[model samples]
Target: MAQFDVSLVLPDTLYHGSTMGAIQGLRIKPINKEFWKDAKDFGAGFYTTIDLFQATTWARKPVVAMERLNKGTDPSAMVRSLPKDQIPVVAVYDCNSNLYTDNIILHDYRGESRAWAQFILSHRHSSTVDNCLCLNEFGWIHPHIACGLMADNDTGQIIEDFRSQGRDIHNRDDLEWFWTQIIRTREGRRLNGLELGDQIAFSAKL
Candidate 1:
């Protein structure tokens, strides 16, 4: 199983599929337009960031789906950070900009995923996200499999059911493989070690 340590910037909620024995450290730091950039370091190394904007309207499955469907976009910040030659990242067209989304895996409770999945699936392309989740071969809720979401009981049931039907569910195993690819591929890691002074690093012994 792929081990993970997630740092939560917001309190009062837990992400799905935290590692089987993962240790999550929570820090309550209010983020606004003025504070968003400062929050980047709070999510170093295999972590997720929950912006204050996200916290306001992030709940509800259909809302996420519709947002991706109607206005999904990849932001300049993420695009500028991505190394070339990786699987193409989807960018949604907004009023005057793009938003980059890294969450492609399904939600824990609502089974939601990144916006790209629907786009790829809708376009009839085999979604890399689907393959990654299905082929992981670990328990349904492994962080590698679940990606940015938690692995709650409902999420577990959906995964098992999908597995029984021979469905592709990317789990922890797939995430490990994906990370391996990122680490090994030249283009994928091309940006590695670049002096991004704004990035934050936080870790604690479990």
Candidate 2:
């Protein structure tokens, strides 16, 4: 369990898991309209992790999501819904530590701080297609890299909890506060080996 810190030099290798098959190269894309629609810890970008197991876990997310939705969800149904010829993949990349020099812009959120929680809320509130913060000048110059904890789905029920209480998931400030209030609780789960892992997201092509 190596701790991933974007503020420090990245490891020489990183793993990206997705339903998409082998890719020719990495590309920067907007935050996807994923099945969960839960806010990404870091905004739209190329997300890779220090943990191979974590990547493998994400590679099977579509199937996992389906399995969680119902006791006996159809694997074929999930397969048919995805793009043709799609299969779960864990792509490995060779990283250049030298690339993270002073010239590069990075927003590294360390630990579970209130500011980190605030940043997540800010981007989540602006993630709608029409209001993508990444596309606007008002946004924080869109860091070349954004890094933070990758588990907003541990119980797989936080979103539902918000809904059950009529909480506004999109309210930036409110969501930030709510997350901090519960960050300690999630930390305990990690101690018990139910961690969701860490991710370093790149907005720059490098």
**Candidate number achieving the greatest TM-score relative to the actual structure:** 2
lDDT against the true structure, per candidate, is: 0.26, 0.61
TM-score against truth, every candidate: 0.18, 0.65
Superposed model 1: Cα runs more than 4 Å off: 1-45, 52-115, 118-153, 168-206
For each candidate, C-alpha RMSD in Å?
Answer: 18.1, 6.7
Q: Lowest lDDT 10-mer window, candidate 2?
A: 29-38
Candidate 2 C-alpha error for residue 137, in Å: 11
Assess candidate 1 and give its TM-score to the true structure. 0.18
Each prediction's total of clashing residue pairs, residues at least 3 apart in sequence or on different chains, is 30, 0
lDDT (C-alpha) at residue 146 in model 1? 19
